[model samples]
Target: MTVLDPAMVPPRDARAAFRDGLVTPTAGWSAGWAQANLLALPKDRAYDFLLFAQRNPKACPVLDVTEPGEISASIFDGDLRTDLPAYRVYEHGEQVAEVGDVRDHWRDDLVCFLIGCSFTFEAALLDAGVPVRHLERKSNVPMYRTNRACRPAGTLSGPLVVSMRPVPPELVATAVRVTSRYPAVHGAPVHVGDPAALGVADLGRPDYGDPVEVRPGEIPVFWACGVTPQAAVAASRPPFAIGHAPGHMAITDVRDSAYAVP
Candidate 1:
């Protein structure tokens, strides 16, 4: 048997667990469908944040955005306030609370942005015979904050974030080629061999998510992450912000193939 089951998991099944307060990180579920990283902010700051995403496509590729007071996305048809496994509340650049749902924090003037996530590519990797160490070890994908600075857009600016996976040397090229086809989902590895090039000091202590062992003969591959916007939230210190807890993403109805390039 494989590390993770290859069968497609319906998005609603995962959403139901999240709505019921089962706050599990969404690394292995809802295969084949796309997963999203959510960022909700007040309408007043939406433009700046949108501009920031446009400037840093690799880290913040946008998939959908919701109108003020809207709870569902038109593109995917899921509850923004409750679909994700966990939500985070940030105030003045600091994470203040983590909750199972954000119903109490909902506001009419808030605009929600759904950013592309790296998890969308995991299904493809597993199908192509790539071993995802985290899935094999039943741990969250390790992510690190990089020293690289994303170009500033309006008031948002911060370091890039990356998700790490250990790939066998023989399959590294296949991993890159398969994932490169999906540009909308944090496409391809930004760095393949060394974490130090991105200023990541240690793989064991990630800024977000849990660490998995990198077995010998497997090289760590880093991909640009949707969490990059979280760094901006830390730096800009927006008065009020909400996001999916790292690794706890919103499963979308959209298929992963829809985001893949020719």
Candidate 2:
């Protein structure tokens, strides 16, 4: 079979590759489609997380949610258990396994939440002449867990996580403007200039995903990340939970334009 370019493949085919056991970051795949971070929690804890996501909208902009026990959503037409390139399974806040398929660990009471991913806005950024360094390097976007804490909801709370992209200083404004239009996919950058301001001590060391080079004259821009929920799962110690591995997102059928604003 001829391998389709990641940018040219449609969402369904992108998901099909993942289902076929491909394990790779979704950042540059299915270019014009929206990607999502997945969080599957037992029905018993659903309402608490719903409130948690509601309270932390910037880090957890929800796009679609599946009813308890369901594998598909309105925006994502693929199998939730098998379509994502990788999954992190947590037990009492401890990640016990990372796998390509979660069917063995799946629970019938799981309620899946699909949170918007910044990858959805990357094509727009590239279109606007801003560079996404990780894409160029063929690596996962760097993610850091901040010292800042999210507002607590019921029993759920954790530090905010941010994804870093090195934008050329001259195009920083364009990067901001392009991304801000997509509010659901973590619109705009939360921090720019100094990573120290967000308590990130070292740009070379990230809490999740691989670190990339920040070229001379390029500013490291930070955006709120959907991986925040997984951080919550670790901190809050939920008995059982599942999340997309950082940078391994669900490629939904929804178009990027659906979440963009004027």
lDDT of 2 by residue, 126-201 (tens): 9998889999998999999998899889889999999999988889999989999999999999999899989999
Off by over 4 Å in 2: 1-3
Q: Every model's Cα RMSD, please?
A: 2.5, 0.9
- The prediction achieving the highest lDDT against the true structure is 2
lDDT of each: 0.90, 0.95
Model 1 clash pairs? none
Model 2 lDDT-worst window of ten: 2-11
lDDT of 1 by residue, 31-90 (tens): 888999999999999999999999999999999999887999966677888888899999
In model 2, what is the error at residue 143, expressed in angstroms?
0.4
User: Runs in model 1 with CA error above 4 Å?
Assistant: 1-8
